[model samples]
Target: MSLTRVLWFAGVIITLAMGIRHSFGLFLEPLSAGGGRETIAFAFAILNLLWGAAQPFAGAWADRAGARRVLVAGALAYAAGLWTLAVPGMPLLGSVMIGIGLAGTTYGVVFGVVGKLAPPHRRSQAMGLTAAAGSLGQFLLLPAGQWGIDHLGASPTLLVFAALTLLIVPLAWPLRVEGIERPSQPVGDAFREAMRHPGFLLLSASYFVCGFQVSFVGVHLPAFLADRGLSSSVGALSLALIGLANIVGTWLFGHMGARHDKSRLLSGIYACRALAIVLFVLLPVTPASAIAFSAAIGFLWLGTVPLTNGIIAGIFGVHYLSMLGGLVFFAHQLGSFFGIWLGGRVYDSTGSYDPVWWASVVLGVMAALLCLPIRERPLQRAEAGA
Candidate 1:
């Protein structure tokens, strides 16, 4: 198959995988009722942590074994995880399994595949397209899950997700290829080299804020809206609008990353996030305004994924793309842990989401500043030789 077809196929599968994984947040209330908030939180936290931690190993395995097999296994695991969710008292185990499934299936694997397929000049755009597709999944699936919950209830909703996950198998077929030989860099040395790079560290750090903001909002926004006496549908719509807006945003940023300075664009994106949060908090809490905020913020959402992945490809090489991206993603998930857990903690203590909202704004501004000093150029000539 042509590279374009390969990318398109990868994009579809990755998006669906990510979308389905993300929709797990919709199960928060139901799972919490079955267990407790702590149980649900712990389950999801375990998922996020495992997802983050497993990335490097998954990436390394993909690098050695080829993305196709890893992706296939991931899809199967994803389905199994969803099936586990259908069983009573299984959220924690289900989440960990789901994390493993997602770690192998989504951006870390797909972006690595794109890095190998796409020419250096086109890598940014390819990453953008992939990220945009994931946003599209979020747009399409979150509401569908909500509708299923309203009409069919939670168990059936998850079964539907499991069925959707089976689509990944066919998608993985195109991705199967013989493994390519890589330069003989020791794994430890490669990781150490990446860790020492200032740009990589900045990229990882800035991504933490993205995780925190997204996780906190994704997990808590519905509850917050309900607290304000809005219908559950409004909350669902708000999340969907954000997902929809991200489609446009991811596409735009992808194009921009190819032509503009990625670090500067990243800085601008974070700055916009800070402003958006301020407006969201300052504005009156209403369904219309909330939806508007969701759309605006969504445009900025996941815009970082492509640029960040592109930066890794640009600085390192496609050979290590998955490993490096996974490391960065690990940082992102760490932030997600704190964001979701802390949002709940703060709300429980204060009975309002105001503090969490303001914290996100502050973190956004800080991340914007952190991104400014990133060196977007390739590594030193001697280092490249090494």
Candidate 2:
């Protein structure tokens, strides 16, 4: 019942969930050694799609049945999904299972509980701290994952990660809310209301760009660096740098979200992302430059998470925060599906990632424009508790 206790457990769980997820890029080289770049990318793409598609349902169930149930189930599935990756012919199944598992274990379910635990005034900060914990995981775990692949074989490394993921099962208990927080309106009515809101639509559209840009970079950046004659360690360090910067960025943005206009903040973050990508690509490829780029992009990374969720909570109220956030995240994942799959397709055909990099810049500008118009206030119905 203590907010501290809840945030602590929730933060650890996110660290594990997101940390491992971020390291998936590290596996691409090892997996693609047999010439299946698209295959691996598609598997990851499926993971994002399934995670997005299942999130609303997962969040809804957490809203009603409690997050412990959803999180524990998700942890089991996540572990199973990882173990399944050891099977030589079942990457698709592994990806699908992991995707569904991620839906239950990560943002939607965890934020649902945290949203209820923290008071409205401190809500954005709490979410930011929790998301920062995830960035910390990325910072710590990326190198560890790369080490595992270096020492143990990739399959063995995956098995170890599977074992580690099971830790989420016990971590789920501390996150249990005291009681269900019922929505002010029926679930169907909430969905319909969200559908009619222009701001939510615009927010979701911009989030799609977030997903497209982040996913493409997360999955393909390693290969892109390799194509430029960088070592695998450079690639791993680049992702770790992103994670490291994300810790500050997520926390800073979350703290600011409490004070500023979240929509405008989001617009700036996207614009910065486009600028970072442009600089990274146009400049020469070197380890120092990659690290600088990673740090810059990373600072802007996942800053979107807390801000986006905070905006949704502001607009919809916390009672349906998880479900509404899930809906918005589904848009993000849809962008992820395209961005990642497209990166692989383009690279496979053109032998370069230049086109997708340009596409990300274009989408970033569009998202920045889109965020300018979002009305961050709650609906009248929500304010009135109708």
lDDT of all predictions? 0.84, 0.91
**Model 2 Cα shift for residue 171 (angstroms):** 0.5
How many residue pairs clash in each candidate at the backbone level? 0, 0
**Candidate 2 on 253-319: residue-level lDDT in tens?**
9999999999999999999999999999999999999999999999998999989998888888888
Give per-model TM-scores.
0.95, 0.98
- Candidate 2 clash pair list: none
Candidate 1: stretches off by over 4 Å: 34-36, 176-181, 381-386
Clashes, model 1: 0
Global CA lDDT of candidate 1, please? 0.84
- Considering summed lDDT, which 10 consecutive residues are worst modelled in model 1? 30-39
lDDT per residue (tens digit) for residues 1-386 in model 1 = 56789878988997799787667667777666744455676677777778888888888888767888888898888888888988888887788888899888998988888878778888899889988898888888999999898899888899889988989987897885445567477777779999999899999999999988888888788878888999888888888888889999998998899999999999999999999889988888998889889999999999999999998888887777888899999999988888877776777678787988999999999999999998677775364565
Root-mean-square deviation of every model: 1.8, 1.5
Write down the RMSD of candidate 2 (Cα, Å): 1.5
